[model samples]
Target: MTMLILFELPQVMMMMMRMGMLMMMTTTMMMRRMLLLLLLLLLSLLLLIMSQ
Candidate 1:
């Protein structure tokens, strides 16, 4: 019904927005961690190559 939808729409929209923000935050954090890990690995590889 229109009344039920009207009442529920704002709450549903808020929930979706919150979820989207959380997902974006988590993915960005994961990406940063992955980049750091890759950088560390690359540095270690360079060090190993230089040591030889």
Candidate 2:
């Protein structure tokens, strides 16, 4: 009912915020990993170019 929803609204909002934060943390972690991989690839490419 409307009343129940209104009472639970704050709890729902808190849950949403928590989920959003978790998602952002995971996204940042992925971004860091991707960046490291890219850096390594670039370094390898540079080394190959230098060797040749």
Candidate 3:
């Protein structure tokens, strides 16, 4: 049992690492989407001002 647990340790660690990386990627994607939205809003505001 101990040997099996020891052998599986690396797999568990890898899974944890993958989960952490996926979380980081999702957060970054959210940030980028927010930034893009802000940019679009700014562009629309500028267009409205120009039309005035």
RMSD (Cα, Å) for all candidates, in order, is 0.7, 1.1, 1.5
In order of listing, the candidates' clash counts read 0, 0, 0
- Candidate 3 C-alpha lDDT tens digits along 1-52: 9999999999999999999999999999999999999999999999999999
**What tens digits encode model 1's per-residue C-alpha lDDT throughout 1-52?**
9999999999999999999999999999999999999999999999999999
lDDT tens readout by residue for model 2, 1-52: 9999999999999999999999999999999999999999999999999999
Deviation from native of the Cα of residue 34 in model 1, angstroms? 0.4
What lDDT score is found at residue 43 in candidate 3?
A: 100
TM-score of each: 0.93, 0.89, 0.76
Model 1 worst lDDT window (10 residues): 1-10
Q: Residue pairs in steric clash, candidate 3?
A: none
Candidate 2 versus truth, CA RMSD in Å, comes to 1.1
After TM-score superposition, what is the CA distance of residue 28 in candidate 2 from its true location, in Å?
0.6
Candidate 2 wrong stretches, greater than 4 Å: none
Local distance difference test, candidate 1: 1.00
Candidates' C-alpha lDDT: 1.00, 1.00, 1.00
**TM-score-sorted candidate list, best first:** 1, 2, 3
